[model samples]
Target: MQDRMTPAERLAAVLMGQKPDRVPVNPFILGFAAKIVNLPIGDLYADPRKSFRAQLLCAEMYGYDATPMYAYASFGAWEFGGEVGMPYEPGQSAPYIIRHPVESPEDVDKLEVPDPRKAGSIPIAMEIAKLCYENKMPVVFQAGEVLTTAANIAEPARLLRWMIRAPDVVHKLNKKVAEFFIAVAEYFTSTFGADKCMAFTGGPVESNKLINPRQFGEFVFPYMKQIHSKVLGMGVHVILEHPCSDQNANLPYYVQLRKELGWNGKYIWAFGPETPLEKQIECFGEHDIIMGNVDPPSFQFKSFEDVLALCKDNIERGIKNPSGYILGVGCELPPLAPPINVYALMKAAREYGRYQ
Candidate 1:
């Protein structure tokens, strides 16, 4: 225990597949923090000040090495000058999206990517990033893939349908969306310092579970690569990448995408809850850091023992990876997850994730 690294050093060292005192306990806590802090979900997402405090509280409470950004994925909608409808949920923070801005190919032609520094939530997101950097808390400043952002403003179904029926329109829209994220990534890396800044540049739209390789190749992959390359070019080594929920089947394609683009950047790919752990270790062991797929929703019902086992199970397999691994929730932990589960998880990591 005396020889173990601090949380910051642990994450950095393990990411390079170097020795860490123990496996880093960096779960993706978002709404979970809001819920525990008693802040209304929508309010926290609206104000970066509250968001920053909530994240600080989470790091203090769970001893997490980092905070996952974006409890609501509507920043792109806000930046694009699209309307967002906020609806209340029965037990949790409001997850909101108003309407699709790009209802037709004609709309794509009108889409304008704004400057990140002045864009809607982009400035607010930067404030939060700066706070995290200043406090020495690692965090993802720009999150959600270009596809998720584009889909939020353009509508998901519409984006997918146009992929087949109106491919040209999709390309136009993706290029603009990708360009916007590149600017945001550049700003974050340059302002906060690349080592402290990270962003999730991959998600559902390109996953094999949701879209076939051919479809992704045609509609999403190129823009994702462009954004990925530009983000790395800014000297941000640890880029956060992922597939949508339960889309681990697309893992191989992600590796291929990185190779094809000659991405020489360090990366962190969060494994989905349903993504096979064994397979994740087998495939990602060579080059990147793999975070776990701990399903956050289950923590609502699962006993402390259940959460403990889940953490231990993942740690056992994750620590076997030759590259690097970190314990992470499958997605954002919901408001109802038992607070005890947080302790249960960290306990498992501390005890089992030790580098014997």
Candidate 2:
């Protein structure tokens, strides 16, 4: 059972289209890292030094095969001049927007791309990115998808209403959000060199549970096209797209977007649990690296054996992915997830995910 390669080596092999000794367990660990180091979830975001430390410490503790990364669901509010409420309570996992910057249609015209170097969590995130770079790891940046970030800047319900009543305003806001995303990419490219950087994005707002496929085409596709095209143009190594939750109805549009942008193998699609692995592989083909779909809530609520069963099933299919496969949690690991259950993911991978 002894490994033939280190975690870094295994990850590099996959990234380079080479076979590894086994499937790598890249847990989408966030606040869980803080828990490992005995820091409150709030410090995980408010203090870059501590955040970076916690992530590394937790990864070392679990012996996982991925580098530390910084990201949060509520990404845009503070960056675009709104207030954010950092999580300080026991069960709270991520920060939330206390006040959205845009309250009305008029505010959309007032939007401007904030300077990435000094903007909200960018500075804090940059601190972690630099730490990763200095330690010879990929400089990770969470340059979120356009529609989701725009929703954070305004509000989700407001954007939904606007999508029906005032489509023009939604487009205007998305344009500005796209610009901000591009600007952040530019900054990361300049600071860390494009080869050393990795962009992380997620699409929770565009989930079928939130909007239908038509809404995705109308509001999500165009700006996502622009963001992906421009960010890839910056020559970053890869963009990890986490299409979170119930996106089966909108999966084809994602394939279409990739086709339209000519991004054949430029993305790493980490899907949520609601999307089956068979469907994900069918949609993405043998071009992109497929990362995940393990139901994350199980870590907090289920037994270790139950968690192991899920990981085993995911690996059985995911290991056959022609392009590549990474064993990862579907979403961020819940802060309150039992330690033994979290360990089940790695245990299952080691037992059943070994490459022939």
Candidate 3:
């Protein structure tokens, strides 16, 4: 079955709640893109121009159906006056926080919200957004999830301990992070016009594997609701929420947050493989688009056939979703993943993800 629509058309159709000729493939590729273009992975995070160019090249080569965008998991550290080390080595995929800003409770009180346009990676991200706008693609921006960004600033261990020992301090830090993300939402939407921007963020630190449901409810849910609600209220139509790992236990809270925000049919939830695809659909299939659950490491360590098999299974299941589905990796496409294995996603979309 030949594709009846271009990649953009296919995605547009899905966004509008209509079926296209086939499922769109948007594997959560990032550092892997730099590798494909023979650039060091560090360039993907440290240099916005290089990152966007590599991503565009890789997407064209793979014939995938997603626009190039920039973000790293360790988002808050550098933006809030901490330091980060870029991915300079072969195995390193993203910049890591080298120095956390809030080393003590006093630091949290002293923390100030930096200008979104000039702070840490926001400048880099703005450059990418400009390129995307120039190229007539959606201008995407990262709006940090409250807990994850706060954890980055305070250091995860200290943040978690603070949740128990100094609950007030934790809330204060989260409040500040929320302020930063709200400011980011305001800046991006104002710069690009909310109608033209897509806001995205993930919750790796708030994953159920590390924190239980009660903790997520207490620490993660309220702030996330505030940030996303503000983003949507600002006229940003779509938000991509990637709950990065084992968040099955946290699904109810997410569903509740989505409801309170009234983001029905205007959100995309991309789950990590640790959260079953069935569960994702069960939670959000009535309205939002469901993407992912493909194991990222399989693209690096498994055979092409095995990778395709995984894609096939996900597509078969996800295609049944009422809202829509996209073929994608649960997390960042590993930098070392074989090109053939990455291509397997597109192949699976073509072979088994057809609508007619």
Error of 3 at 143 (Å): 1.0
Task: Note the residue pairs that clash in candidate 2.
Answer: none
TM-scores for every candidate against the unseen true structure: 0.92, 0.98, 0.98
Writing each residue's lDDT as its tens digit, candidate 1 over 15-48 gives: 6679688788777777777778887766567678
Give a tens-digit lDDT track for model 3, residues 167-242.
9999999998999999988998888899889989896898987899999999988888888888888988888889
Evaluate all candidate structures by whole-model CA lDDT and list the values in order: 0.73, 0.87, 0.89
User: RMSD of each candidate?
Assistant: 2.3, 1.1, 1.1
Q: What shift in Å separates residue 151 of candidate 3 from its native position after superposition?
A: 1.0
For model 1 the local lDDT of residue 292 reads: 83
Candidate 2 Cα errors over 4 Å, as ranges: none
Residue 154 miss distance in model 1 (angstroms): 1.3
**Order of candidate numbers by lDDT, starting with the best:** 3, 2, 1
Which candidate comes out best when scored by lDDT? Answer: 3
